[model samples]
Target: MAQALAAAGARVLVVEPNAPHRLPGLLGAAAPPPEGQGQVAPGIWGLFLDPEIAMAAYLRSQVRVRAIAERMVRSKIYQRFVAAAPGLKELIVLGKVMMVYRGRHQVAGVGGFDQVILDAPATGHGVQLLRVPRLTLDTFGESPLTREARRVQEMLQAESTFVDVVTLAEEMPVNEALELEKTTRDLLDFQVGSLIVNGLCPPIGEAAAAWDPGELRADPRIAGAHYAATWCDARRRMQQQHLRRARAATRAPLECLPFVFSADEREVVAHLAAQLRATGASRREAC
Candidate 1:
């Protein structure tokens, strides 16, 4: 999706907070050869936000001293204290995202990305991350931390910020997607912009139903083809069922990403991006 948006002439930055290795592994040969943050494609760039690195950058911005920021972030006591504090880590992560969202970071003289995409934590932790600012404000009154948190909260709640929910076309994941949508609205008052149902098998049931598989049983090759088609048709039907349930569960727009048969993650992302673009629902401003 990032690639598609970037291809459409939007400056895009993908921030991976969950697993740094995941995005790099996906971009594969398309990823820039150099170390640290680099462009994944012409208009799309990737960033891996290590907690310590994010802390150092943030502290440097606050203190205006790189050496002091480095010392503070490297301190064992500071690390332990940050880990011990509830929502502190989540707050910091969100704060870093807000920085990028608002073009407040200067790394090697490159800053102000037009669009910042955060591959944030899973549903539960993501909810917690969004709630941290309000929680801190309520608990700590007024302080530098809470002040920063408030800024992040405002950005998150802004109309320009959108929460996209992605899930598999299955029972459990669909249910979870519904729950996540509700939680985002109820807890953070953020409406889910869309529900992306990934890995949908092609619907071949109509063609399968018109064919007679028994006639091909005598030929192994034909029989194998028939069997594969039958299996795919069944899976597609199942997915359609789940997709219907998902649509009924939410009022938000829903999109299905067809299953791609490729070992390359870059190909998969490209396929999904194409699907996203075709939907004619790509919100350039909110992305």
Candidate 2:
């Protein structure tokens, strides 16, 4: 989503809280070549500031980083991405991204930009991070951290952004997706913007088209029409079941990322932008 937002002409500030390369390739090659690369794409600025400070400045500095990162990414365009990605602007994101900044849910940083897409971690950890701002606000009573926290919270609650959550599209992911939503409502008390079901599906509809209905209950002109139909039906039903659950489970809109059985991640981000455009999300947000 960082790539997607950046492509749409937003100054992106990627906050990274995880240990550098603790889990390499998580960000993938979704990065532009080193400065030597061709004219890099627009609307992205990643700064991987480590939360543990293994790579970041420090405990105090990390707080500053969150506000700065948020301020950098708030684009007013109110649109979804629609362009070729430039990969990473630099090797670093803003800060320890893998960690969520608690009580800092309302991001006032990355100010002036229209949107702020956090590559935040899961609910268990992420929720805890988001609550920090609120906690500090209650305890600190109008300190600088509290000010930043409220801003971050507002952004997260912004109609345009809901501490939007991103997780793999699987049983655990889906369950986490819900838990994230509920936790936000009950604990942080914010509504998440959308649930992105990433890399989902085995292409039931297309596979069904491959089989011949008439060939079924016959001498089998094909490999096995009956079996194919059953498989396709089951798969389609499963896909629908997920969709139904998404609709039924939470109030947040569910977005599907077509099963990329074998498509480049770069292509996936591009396609995602296109799909969002077609759905008028970009335009609607603009309004």
Best by lDDT: 1
- Please provide, for model 2 over 1-287, each residue's C-alpha lDDT reduced to its tens digit, 9 standing for 90 to 100: 55566556665545444534211133344443332111124554444334323322322354567865344344332112111111111111221222222322222233344443455556776766676556545655565445655655564564554666555545666777888888887778776666666655555556655556774456664546557766656666666666667657866666666555445655666676666645454322210
Give candidate 2 misplaced runs (Cα > 4 Å). Answer: 20-40, 54-112, 137-160, 167-172, 202-233, 282-287
TM-score of every candidate: 0.88, 0.59
Per-residue C-alpha lDDT of model 1 across residues 1-287, encoded as one tens digit per residue:
67777767787888776544477667554443354576766777777667656666667778877788778888888888777767776677788778777778643346767777878677787777778888878877678889898998898888888788888888898998999988888778976777878898876555865599786689999887788888888888888898889888876777778899888777898888877777755533211
Name the 10 consecutive residues with the lowest summed lDDT in model 2: 82-91
TM-score of 1: 0.88
Residue 25 alpha-carbon offset, candidate 2, angstroms? 7.0
lDDT of each candidate versus the true structure: 0.75, 0.50
Alpha-carbon runs more than 4 Å astray in model 1 = 28-35, 60-71, 282-287
